[model samples]
Target: MALLSHDAGGKPVRAASGANATLYCNESTAGLSMLHKELAQLDERVQRLIAAYRQARLERKRALQERDRLLALNAELKRRIEGVVERIRLLESDQAQ
Candidate 1:
């Protein structure tokens, strides 16, 4: 007897060609059910990975904005310090005279 049967969809049909046809059908059904469960698990994992990628991209953008703000603040502080130094030098020269 043939150990396997084919359905119209080409998936293994749950039947045997001979006396043990019932047992074959049960086994085939169980296998297909397990395959469906595994596929569901894989799908959930893929969705979680996609969510994590989006979160990482958002964090990177925030970091870049913070870096730009700090750079602007540093430039402003440097300009103020240079102005103060020039004033101190002028004051010292006037007192010396």
Candidate 2:
């Protein structure tokens, strides 16, 4: 059931659900033709915010991928350096003998 009544001036009043609640119209409509315009503006703002959030999520994923790649490269370089050091140590031992 809709909770509504008309004031003496013929303006619609929100009743029942609200305590002597009065507006030009329903709470959702908020009265008049202004409601449509306001709803459109609010929708546009929400869409823009959602798009920004999606772009940020994509950038974060790409950054994580790059970090993993660099870490792998560092590990490979460490292995190669350690191998070279071991060879140098063996050469010194042979020379000393």
Candidate 3:
């Protein structure tokens, strides 16, 4: 399914036979360059994660503020309902008398 070759270091290099693609390996500095490339990729990934974390924190803060406002609104509605119920009870007692 694939082609395999070796460099001076005898490292197995895999390539796609259909695409006629090969890995050009320079035994002198392939490992060092690959290491640097991997490090760069890792740094980019870490930066993306940090940005996502900051965005999540901002969204969570906004959600908590909305929840607090809703709770305050709920308390106010409950107070108004209690006042109405008390007036109804007073009217009932007066009718009975």
Task: Give lDDT tens digits, candidate 3, residues 6-65.
Answer: 656998756654434433334325776887999999999999999999999999999999
The runs of at least 3 residues in candidate 3 whose Cα sits more than 4 Å from the true structure, single-residue gaps closed, are 1-25
Give each model's whole-structure lDDT.
0.86, 0.78, 0.80
Candidate closest to the true structure, highest TM-score: 1
Q: In angstroms, give how far residue 7 of model 2 lies from its true place.
A: 12
Candidate 1's C-alpha runs over 4 A off are 1-14
Worst-scoring 10-residue span by lDDT in model 3: 19-28
TM-score of each: 0.76, 0.64, 0.68
- Tens digits of per-residue lDDT, candidate 2, 1-97, equal 3646566699875555444343433454455358688889999999999999999999999999999999999999999999999999999999999
Task: Rate residue 66 of model 3 by lDDT.
Answer: 100
Alpha carbon lDDT at 9, candidate 3: 100
Winning candidate number (lDDT)? 1
